[model samples]
Structure formats: C-alpha cells, structure tokens
Target: MNGPRERGRPGGADAADRALDDAVALANGPATARPGSRQPSTDPLVVALGHEPAGAGPAQARTRARQRPDAVAWPEARRLARRVGRRLDPRALPLGEDLLGMALARSLTALTDLPSFDSSAMDGWAVAGSGPWRLKGQVLAGQQRSADALLGGHAVRIATGAVLPPGTTAVLRSEHGSTQLRTDGEWLHVLASHSAPRAGQEIRRKGQECRGGEELLPAGAVVTPAVLGLAAAAGYDELTVTMRPRVEILVLGDELLDQGPPRAGRVRDALGPMLPSWLRGLGAEVTSVRRLVDDAGTLHAAVAASTADLVVTTGGTASGPVDHVHPVLAQLGATLLVDGVAVRPGHPMLLAQLPAGGLLAGLPGNPLAAVSGVLTLVDPVLRTLAGRPAPAPYAAPLTANVPGHPVDTRLVPVVFDDESAARPLHFTGPAMLRGLAAADGMAVIPPGGARAGQETAVLDTGALAPAWGSGA
Candidate 1:
C-alpha cells in the first residue's frame, strides 16, 4: 500500500514524529472517550482536558518561563507562584488599632493623613492679622471647648495640636509675645509681634499630606515602623491583611549534629542555627524545625503527620546513595513541581507540592546552595504566604564582567549606591558563601547571559538602613 519508495535512509520513517503529534493531539482529549462522545468547548482547559475529564488535575501551571520576556529562567519560580496564588489569602482591619497580634502577621493596607486636621504645630499664640490685642485665654491640647470667647484684637496662648478659634489665622511662638497687667482691673495686656503674622502659617491642614481613605500604602506592603505610624495617623483601628504561612523545617543528614562534640567525620548543623533568622525576614512564622537522619521511613512518618502550612527540608534531595528525600517524596505521592533547577550550587534544590495542601522545598547540603535556595525559591514562597507582592527587581548598569552559563539565572551578591542604585561587587559560585555574606543584596544574571558593561537587575536586601544625622 506504499505510494512510492521514499528516497531516504533505511530507518528514515517519520513514525516517531507522527506518533508524537498524534499523542499531543490526544493529550487535549480524554483517554476513555467513546466514539460518539461530544467534543468539549474550545476554552483552553475545556479543550485540553475535555468535558468531565477527571477533575481537571489541579490547575495546570503556566510554566512556559522561556516565553516570558524576562531573562531569569527557573521553572520552579512560576509553579511555586501559582501554588502560592491558590493557597494564600489577604484580608482588611479597622483604623486606630496598633498593627500587632494577627495584624502584624499580615501585610498592611495603605496609609492616610498624619494630623488629619488643621491644628497648631507649635506652642504659640494664635492671633489674627489685626494685632494689638488683649489676652483672651489659653488653650492646650485635649481641652474641651468652653464659653471663653477670643475676640478680635485679642490673642490666645495655644499649645501644640490645639484647634484654632475662629478668626485666628496665624501662630506666633511663645518667645515672641509679652504679657503685662493692664491698668483696668478686668484687663490684661498682650503685645503681639509688631510684624502681623501671615494667614495659615504653622497650621497643619486636613488632607494636606494625605486625604481620608487615600492609600497610605499599596497592598502587599510589609508593615514597617514608619508604615505602622502612618496607618495609625489615618485613624485606623485595625487593617485587613494577608496571613503569613506557617512553616516547619526539617534539617536532615547523619553528618550533622547540634550542640554536641563533633564526631570525627560529622559537623555541627549550620541550617539549625541560620534558617530561623532568614525565614523571619521573608515574613514567615516558623512553627517548628526538627533534625532527622537520612532515613526514608522516619522522614515519611514525620512529614505525614506534620500539620504546618509549609515544610522545608534541607539536604538529601539528590540521587546519591544517602539521598532519602527524593525517594521518600516519591513514596508520599508528592507532586514534583521542580525536580532540579539549573542554577549552580543549587542544582539539587527541589520544590514539590505535598498532597496535603502545602509546599515542600529541599535545599542542598552545601552552605552556599542552601542559602541560594532561600533567596531564589524560599523567599518568593514566604512572601506569597505573607500576602506581599513580588517586589520589582532593581535595574543597574553592570560595573564589570559577570561570568555564568547561558541557561542558568545566577544569583550574584551586590551593594547599592547612596541613592539606592545597585552596583555589583564580587562574583561567587553557588558553593561560595563568603561573598554573599559580605554583600548587601543579590543581583540576577538573566538567561542568555550578560557582558561586563550591560545593565542588570539586582534584588536588594530589605534591611533597614541606620538613621543618619540630619545635620550631616
């Protein structure tokens, strides 16, 4: 039935190619559809999985990272993002309450005005433009309004935050005034500044800095002290925010020990001491952390009963003989979201979704890889759990040549200029942790690579800078 002998090599049949195409076409249809089964709707999911197709298999992630315009490429990044979107939730709180308790656990809404009204900004005399007045009375903050009338041609001694009486348009500091007894029994003399005060001077007007209900902070903002104060000034008692994910850590490897004399070949666990502080900066509340030896059964039992919202396991994710994580995860039916990222020193890092509505990330045993995983994978997930937005990367001109493979997104440590402009410092491999500790932030070398003079985007460490002296 061959139409004609094809002029090609003996094994040149395109059967594999044809079969692949057919399989791809059928992948959009249900496997057990009957001959008379009706086609599903053209919507992506409907057409891809067919009508009534086995519970739509946990929302398919948009993992075509290569198609994205950005240079950094990590398959796990997108999958983790979608999983975070599905798992975390954000809510709002009232104005006036301090952002503590659960409120501190969530990202705050925007801020409003500080004073929220026109109030005196200093301890002074509130006077009208037509001075040469008599002493009317004195007013301090928190004093209730009384029948004391501040007449025209009179001045009132005012304390900070006091509401100005009608017709008073300016405030002259207390040092500028002279009060004296008048000859009349019922009068006291007041000499206001000879230069009549200007109207609206030293007054904080309502909505001057921020109006009522104006966003004092964008959504997904980390509630810092400044942000906290701003929110309070807006008259908010409480604010709705996204809840942070509860995390549990398990540091595995028989070569690790804690607080004991180091055995000949073993060492003290670095993760046990370092991970908690690192996790907090990502806004995650670590519920628990345990150390377990590399045993599949033991790890499985521990993970099965763990109730945390997320679990991070360190070491033992590779294919080495002692690597129990991969096998145990497989046995537990964990969905492999990311088996291995191409980034150096972090090649063994794994991101998987636990069957029980949470995520599991595995970091390599090396100190550098372990830290890299935190910055690249763990940081994003923790931010998601905290309901914070993915911060935009900071762009900077590369000061020198940064080397790396064309496919991997390299994380290089860097510092910033006084004006917050990022500048790369040293290049450290994934196995090198010294440079990372010295640098203030990490810059990403996007896939397709970069030259010494090209501009690059750096991720800044969100550390609070020291308060500088104003006079300096």
Candidate 2:
C-alpha cells in the first residue's frame, strides 16, 4: 500500500520561486522607491509588471508577480520542518516513553522479550504425566518456587502467572476436578478423578510468550499508554523517542484583536486561541504566538523575529490591498515550499522556510480555510518529525451521494457508524465547523471525482476504533 503522495508536485512552490526572482529583478530596477512612503519597494515584481504594490488589483499584481525561476527543492517551509525534526529521532524513541511522559526525540529500538517467562493460562493442578497423581502443595502468584518438586504421582496447585515448578506438564482447573480441595491436618489435599495431564495442555511453554532477546517493539512508534505498558512489561525502564517539534504562530490581520469586542469591521482573534490546541494534537509544543497588523513592516518584523520550528501566519496570503505577507516573505529570502495546493477550501495555503532554520505555513483568513491548512500541512510535518510510520488508509463507503469537483481535490467532513464497521457520513463545506463537529473524519475525494454509495479514503479521528481496537 506504500506509495508517493498521490496528488504530485505542489504548484505554489514553483509559483513562489518565479515570483521571488521577478521581485528581485524589480528591486534592482530604477523605480525602487515607493511614492510618498519611506518603505523600500517591497514588491518589485508588481512594479516591473506595471502595477503599484499598494493599490494594484490582486489579479493584475499576482499575474505580474509570476516570474518563473528555476525550481529549487527544500523551500523555506520544508526547512522549518527539517529543523524541528532535527531535534528528534523517530526510530530510537520508545512508544512507552512517548505515550507516558514528555519525551525528547532520539533513536530507539526494542531490547527485551515481551513476555519474559513461561506461564500457565489457567488455574489448575500441575502434573507431569498421563498417569494418576497425589495432591501436592498449592502454588499461587508471588509464592516462591518449590524444590524437590514431584509430578509423577502428585498434583500441585497453580494459579495463572505463578511459576510452574519443575516436573509440571499439565494444568487441570479446579472446575474440572471432582474434589478440588479438602483440608487435612496441615495440607490441602486434592483428589484426581482422571489421569495426569499431557504435554502442552494449559501450559504456556518457554519462549512461547517471547524469547529473552526478541524485539518487543519497532522504532518510530509514538508512545501511547498501551504501548508504554507493553514496553514496561518487556522490562524497559527508559525509552528513546522523537522530540516533539516546536511550533510558533503568528496571527496577521488589522481587524483582529487579541482581546476585546469587535469594533466596526473588526473581529475577535480566531488563530491565536485555536492554534495551540491543534498543534498539541499533532504532538507539537507551541513555543510562542504573535499577532501582527496588516502593514508590510510589521509583518516583516514578525517573520524575522519568529523562532519556532514552524511559523504559521493567518490572513494576507491571498491578493488583497492589505496583503503584504507574500511580499515580506519574498524579501526575507525564504524559499517557497508550497504557495498553493490543488485542494478546495485551502488552495491559498502557503508553505516556506527561512534560511535561519524554521518552517512557515501561510493560511487563508477564513477560519475554515485555516483549519484545512493545519490538517493538510501541519499534521504531516509532525508525523515526519516524530518518525512515525505512515498510516494505512481507512476506507468507508459514502452514506449519501457526494458532489464531484472538477478542478480541485476535496476534503469532505464525514461521520462514521462507530457501532459497527466504520461507515462514512458526508457533510457540508469546510467553513461549517458544526458540520465537521458531527463528523468522525475528513474523506478525501480525488480531483474530478464523483461518488454514490462508493468508497472513499478517510482521515479518521481515531475515535472510531472499538475500545479493544481492530484485531488487525
């Protein structure tokens, strides 16, 4: 099932390179100064293409902004991911440590047998042969092993997890015994109505649980509670784990206020409060958050001061009068990783990395659009940093007819029938948080796709798994 990203190369990365080169050329041109302003011509590409960066229409300026330059891999955004990932090693980190405590990323591998000792599966009498036997002393969990153990004509009481003393072959539960226990003067006697047990009956043989040196877990596994429990049982006290990627957030918008009521066209801050929780879910510790105005100078300073592995800026990514994010980013010599994805609702998504070692994800202004960018960009980066294995796709048939998209790949909210097999329940727009709340996951529809009771790939919330988990 392993394969490359199905959608192919990003168009935004390519677009950003061309735009940067053109902007650079314009910066070296004669019209390098802004009218009635002290700002160095930030968007030279717009000037050269016959437009003003401040008052230019988005369509025209964006068109002029495109000066195709040779594509360079490792755009600024990916470099951020790499920087964050550099602190952690996926393979050396133990699942136990990651799930149980705060873990720094390091390379790790399993070291011990999962189940160390051979034990019995049932509570019964232990006997060596098929012949009859007398009742011996009982052995329960935590009791010391018995010496001079004889099973030829005697049965010893054994409980689950209790070491089977030498000469024990079979375990017959008390329920199967005609007379389980009869108290005598100093010992509890058992009367066997049947012959002694045979080999391997109710007996967990040595190395059957696990060899002493066998591998209990693989590298790059994100530690969960059960994973930790397994490692602990395997006698591991410390585990190496991928260090959590550090993240930084910058909410850009003149209309947004960190606190206080909206005045006129302004709105309450949407990004600052929401980003921390989302980053945590992706296993990242958000180190800082900054809010910047729509001014190019302010935006440039914020980008320059950013110190996290990944810096996410909201608003000003698309073409707008106040949009100075792309221009400021170009000026910083940040490589464009992905300027736009071919997906609906999050097409304006921007990805880049500064030369100084950090990643940047530019999200659209709409709350829904920003959420899409987090899932599409941030989630995968965190996964890569943690060294977790790529997850297999979850498949479910569409509950209702889903509309097709001719131009862009679609991420549709879906609910599942957690009571049985996971079944898909499609919902409305990316903007509809209520609709997403009712969903168990996001279903991916390929570009130019249609569906009617057809199966689709789902990015499940993982809550759909049965409490015991799928046996697979």
Candidate 3:
C-alpha cells in the first residue's frame, strides 16, 4: 500500500545545485539603497512581497511599488491557498494515525456476509417442526453447526448465539418451552400459555443485514471511531484512507532558543513546539520541525530540499535585514501566489509555489501573527489536499467592542458569552498567545471593527471550551 506520491516524484529534497544557484541570485539580487522613508528597515523583502514599507520615500517607494504585486485580501488569500492544493492526488493509505482524520479514498465494502452462519439469537431450542418433539442434540455459542440435519418433530438444545443446525426451521426460546424425559429420546414441548414457536423465530439468518461485497460506506466518508468499529466487524484489519498533506515547519530567527527561558535577547522557541501538534489537528502530517538561524542561504537550502506538500516557515517574512523569505523566493523562481495578505498582525504573511515542487507559507515572527497566517494560508491548503470537508460558515454576535485595522480585517481571539455572543479577549496583540490560549475561536471583525451585539463571522479553532470559557 506504500507508494511514492504520484503527484510525480516522492517529493522531499531537491538538488543542491539548484539551491546554490538560487542562493547566488539572493546574494546579489537587491541593490544597496539608502534608508528612504522609514528609518530602521529597508525595502527589498517588503517591496518584493508587495508591501510598501513605512519608511520608503516617495521616489524610492514609487519605484519599488511598480515592481510589486498587491497584497491579497484576507478572503482571497485563503481561496488562493485552497486552489493550489486542488491538484494533489489523494492516496490509499493504510489505517493508523496516518489515516486518522483523513477522508476515505474509496468506498468501504463489506468483506464478508453479515452473520456468515445461520445462528441462534437467544438461548433456545432449534426445531424442525412444531414441538412436543424429541430432543436430538445440543448446540452452544461458537460450537460447529450440527453435522446431522434436523428431522420433523425433533429439536436441538441450543444456547444463545449458537449456529443453528441445517434444516432447522425455527427456534423455541428456552423460557417459552419445557422439556420432559418420558423416554423415547426426551421430548421438548411449547408452553400453551407462550404458544408454539413461529417460523424462523429467534434464528438469525445469514446475510440479513448485508451480503459480502456490499458497499457499507461511500467514498469521501470520514473515518470516524464508529467507522473503525464497523470496519473491524466487516473483516478489515486496515483501512484504505486518504493521504494527509505532509508539512514541514521551519522555525527561523537566530534570537530564538530551542530550550530554557528567554536569555541574552534570545527568546524560547514557541512555534517549533506548538506547530507540529497544531498542524496535525488541522489534518496535516507534520513531517519535520527544523530550527534555523535567520540566514538566507539556510532558508533557501531548506526550502529547496523539502519534499513535503507544504513548507511552513515562522519569522523572517518582512523587510528587515534578517528577513530572507522574499529574497530566497525570488532566487528560486518561485511564484508568490498570495504574495502578502491584508490581515492585521500577519499582513506580511505570504504563500508561494516553489519551482521544484510543493508550496511554502511564510508566517510573521510574532506568535499570534504566525497563527493568523496559518489560518489564512496553511489551514486551507491542508484541508483541500487531505480531502477534509470545510467547516460550515458560522457567525456570532459580539459581546463587546472589538477594535479593527482601518483597511485590514482583524481576527480577534474570543470566548463565547452567556448568550453565545463572542467576547473579545485582551492581550491579543501580534506577539501574544495568552488570549489565544483562552479563546474558543477568532472573531472576524471587518475593517470598521465590530460593535457589541453586532454579528461577525467566527473561524472555528477546534477547541470549543466549556461554558466557563464564555466568561470574561
């Protein structure tokens, strides 16, 4: 069942030579320019990613603006991400964690007939005809069906769930029938008060539920726990399930520590530890989590070498000196599919297609901003590739005022109120995660912001906390 992804090459690792060429282009790509409008940062990455930096002067900004693609709207960016993944072929994966949460690639068929044998459904007497009959044999659950066929006026003492003997027409339940030993091979009689057993009474006939090879569930059915149980009963040891999108997370920044508390200006790595599980929950198979410094060449090599369906890089998506995502993409001849998004906190987030193969999502440095990028880009792509159904659109009224960016949409982490209104949480700045940790979902506030009692679309975060979470 294991085969290379037929999207062509079993994609992981591109040739180093191509990566080197890309690196060379990165080294000499942007011309050295004096700081124009904003003081600290330059215009290379931002301009290339279609963002007008806060510091660029009129002439320089105008010059750079003409060479850039406009940042995509919040909704459009997500749509682009989904579009890129539509071509990925689903796989016939064997059942396991790999299959968990993935849609079935094909219909699940019954491997064997349901109740493959004629059996007793309860503790009863298997009879050939009306009783007041001779007891000929005995049968218990799991015992072989009687080799001798039953004759008229004869019965077998059968336990619950026992396979009924051939030629048996009906079952007389033990409680409704009485036995006597007047010799002549011990007789069985139906209690007149209970009446005689009817035809096929208490005898579970084979294939009554479903016959062999019948389709039990249609293709596109999700492999839930109940499905697994049903599959086991239908003679399946493994399930043929849809492939999960493979993702590789690259945590960028030299000022990030792999462990220990923040020290010497370096902060503890948050995305590295969290993205793997988060991506898994979103239906992507996180293949690897690599920690790298903010070096263009390292990022370039890593991106080029990855065979994952999607490569996610945290930090270094802006126009800072350390920002290398844009430069690397330019060198690699990659198409900036969703060059940048107009959402707050993650306005610099980008989605790109590597020429070698696969896609990359560039998330902003701040934890919360990175999360926004995931929702805007990574989540949509994975869903399409994994064949997961998109959640139904939903909205909730706001319990309090939610501030918004004038021209950009805001994704505010919120808890539900007593009336099921979405209550915006505090500490929801781009760099913070505290508010998100306490949130049930993110309320999508339009450009003008949302007022109390105003209904706004809410994106499900999958963590539906209890009513206690509804409190401020």
Candidate 4:
C-alpha cells in the first residue's frame, strides 16, 4: 500500500521552495494586467500566488506575510488524500441484496448457466410436426410432465418458462395457430395465413446469457439493482463486497446546544446533526458522534481511544485560546499531513495521521467551512477506501463575477441559470448554510477571482449520495 507517508511529502522541498518563491514574488512584484487591459485585478488568491502588483496595499502585504508557508495548494491536498485512502486495507463483507451500493471486492462468476434448462419462451404449442397435429395436455411452468414422444403430427400446449418435453420440434404461438373441429374430431393446427414455423424460434436455450464459471462483473463494480438481480440469477445468495469505512465524529464547541434554538452566546450544534448523514452518504459507517468540550484533555482522550478508521473533529483547528485540536494532536504524536489549506471558508482545516493508525480530519467550526473541509479531504479518502474511483472533472461558465481570496482558492455556492452557467449565490459566508442548501454545487474560483463568462470547476453536492456512483 502506497500510503501518504510512504510516498514522502507531495511536492517536496523544491515544490515548497517554489511555493515560497511565488508567495514572495506576489508580495514584492506588481500585479499582472489582464489581457487587453491596463489595470490589474485585486483578487486575493491571485495576489497570494505572486500575481499582485507592487505596493498593492499595506493590508494585502501584511496578509501575505502572515500566510503560512506550509499551507497546501488545493490540488496537492486532494492528491495526498487519495494516497491516504489507497494505503488502507479493504475489508470484505458478506454479500446480500442489502449490499447494493457497495463495491465488489472480487469479480463475480456464474455458478450455473443462465436459464439453466431449455424452456418455452412464450405461451404456445410445443409441436413435433410442421402442420396440423394431435393436441396433448398442457404444461405450466415448474411442472414435471412425462408424455410419449410426439409423432410428426402431434403437439402439446405449453406456457412460458415451462420445460420442453422430449421430441419437441418448435413452439407455435397460440395466436398463430387454431383448433379445428372437423370429421377427425378436435385437432390443434397451424393457421394457413402464417408461414412455416421456424425451428427454435421461441425456445430459450441453456446458457443463453452466460455459461457456468463465466465472469459476470469485475472487481470494483458498484452493486446496483441490476447487479443484484444478476447475482441472484447467476446462483449467488451472498456476495463479497468492500466494507464501508468506519468513522467517528467529534463535534467540539462549548457554546453549542444539541437540541434547542440559539440563545445567549450559544448556538445549535449544526455539525453534529449534519456530519453523520453526509458521511454515510460517502460510504462511511459513522460509528459515533461525540460532543466534547474545548478542553485539550477531553479531545486527547477521545483521539487516543477511538477505534474507527477515521476520526473527524469539528472546530478548534486554529491557534485561538479555545483551539485545542492542534495541541491535542501534537501531544498524541500525530503527524500533521496538512496543517492548513489554500482555500476560502475552510483555510483552517487540517489533516493528520494518528499514532493509533487512525486518520484525523480537523474541520473549522463555521458551517460552510466545515462542508468545504469534507469535500477537500473526507470525500476522496472514503471513496478510495470503499474501492471507488474519483469523480471525473467538471466545469461550467460563471454567470457572474465571484470575489476571490487573495492567496486561497474559494468554494462558493451557486445555482445554475437558464443558460446553464453557474451563478454565485448570496449569503455564502463561512458561517452560513442558506446558500448551500439552495445550491446545485460549489464553483471553484481561482485566485484573482473569475470574470463573468469564465469557466470554473464545479463540485456537485448531489455527488455525495450513494446512487451517484463512485462519488458516493
């Protein structure tokens, strides 16, 4: 398993040095002018990435200086996430119809030939001759009927799925044939209007779909409804699927209420109620959601005792007085894989590998920021662990201009307009959820922001649902 640690730091010293150079260059150089324009834009990410003009502003300069040198770029952070996911071993689960949406741990093979036996594919007469014939008894599905071999002019009534009798030649449809009451008494006959019956026309032969021991589905295929039906038909009562990753959430905040309206200085525990459902949608089995105090001891104990594969902590990622996540992680001898990200509304999010073999993702307390952290880190990691592939890249033109962060990428909520362009939504601050709730996805805005009509990457929130394939 090529784990993130074993892979060495992504974009090592030279990359870091280059990032530093870019940062310094942004601080010292003048902003580059847009094509055909004399003035330069003041996008924060652009400024942070060394596109800011010299003497842009004192505040911008100070902000650049204060930026953490170790902050990871958005793309690199995701690459590391994939590495972490690939390192973990996948557990095999017993198969059942309920295992739909789970990934197959191994290829599925047929235990028996499909259709299993030759059977009638329609309700008709199993005839032995080419024309008018003597009628035998009727044979329904699942019935065992024994009769003398049909002579050249004899036939028997048969229903769909009924096994063909001995000496059966071909099936003639009831509508295509008729009963004649003649001097020879009652007789079953083929109609004159119809042409000669084609042999094997309505017979479903054994192994029509698949033969015994044939490969039915490959490993990593998602167990969908069709797959389940196929598995049952192919003689499987159980299937081996990749186990869902176990997750334990720690919602940290002393000013959060579990079941009440906001009052005084406290607010509702938004993350506690939100994380579990979203995590489950991402193919994680949330083992627990524990609310802990802002104290370092409580967090340290929880982190040390967790048995889940991933430990997600909300809030306390910053260096403020109440921020204990960093200190607790440090005390536990955890390796900080990502200290901070170059993204808006979730810049304080962090990732670490614990000494106890569990991974920890520290998300900022703000509602939208926490969501950003989930997409940036948790989403990819769980998908990899579940044996799912990464989602394909998607982009759309912007319907309006979105303000950018000087040095960080921005994930802004947007709704699709009539033109299919993504229009940025309002009330999209780090602490707000209104915009997100009404949004189709979050548009990826680069530094210096994007002008109207510019193409931008979009991350669909609906991709988190299990029905959405590998993104789930």
Cα error, residue 146 of model 2, in Å, equals 5.1
Q: Which stretches of candidate 4 lie above 4 Å from their native place?
A: 1-68, 86-94, 127-134, 144-155, 165-205, 416-421, 462-472
How does residue 394 of candidate 1 score in lDDT?
38
Question: What alpha-carbon RMSD in Å does predicted model 2 have with respect to the real structure?
Answer: 13.8
* Per-residue lDDT value at 353 in model 4: 91
Query: Compared with the true structure, what per-residue lDDT tens digits does model 2 show for residues 310-410?
Result: 78788888878998878998999998767775455666787787878777888887776777677666655665554544343344556665554543446
lDDT of 4: 0.74
lDDT of candidate 1 at residue 187, scale 0 to 100: 29
List TM-score per model, in order.
Answer: 0.74, 0.69, 0.70, 0.77
Candidate 4 local lDDT, 167-202, one digit each (tens):
788899988999876786667876789876788878
**Where does candidate 2 have its weakest 10-residue lDDT segment?**
1-10
How high is the CA lDDT of each candidate model?
A: 0.59, 0.57, 0.72, 0.74
* Clash count, one per candidate: 19, 23, 5, 14
Better of 2 and 3 by lDDT: 3
Off-target runs (Cα >4 Å) in candidate 3 are: 1-69, 86-98, 116-136, 141-161, 164-214, 416-421, 451-455, 462-472
Q: What is the lDDT of residue 18 in candidate 3?
A: 25
Error of model 2, residue 116, in angstroms: 3.1
For candidate 4, report its TM-score.
Answer: 0.77
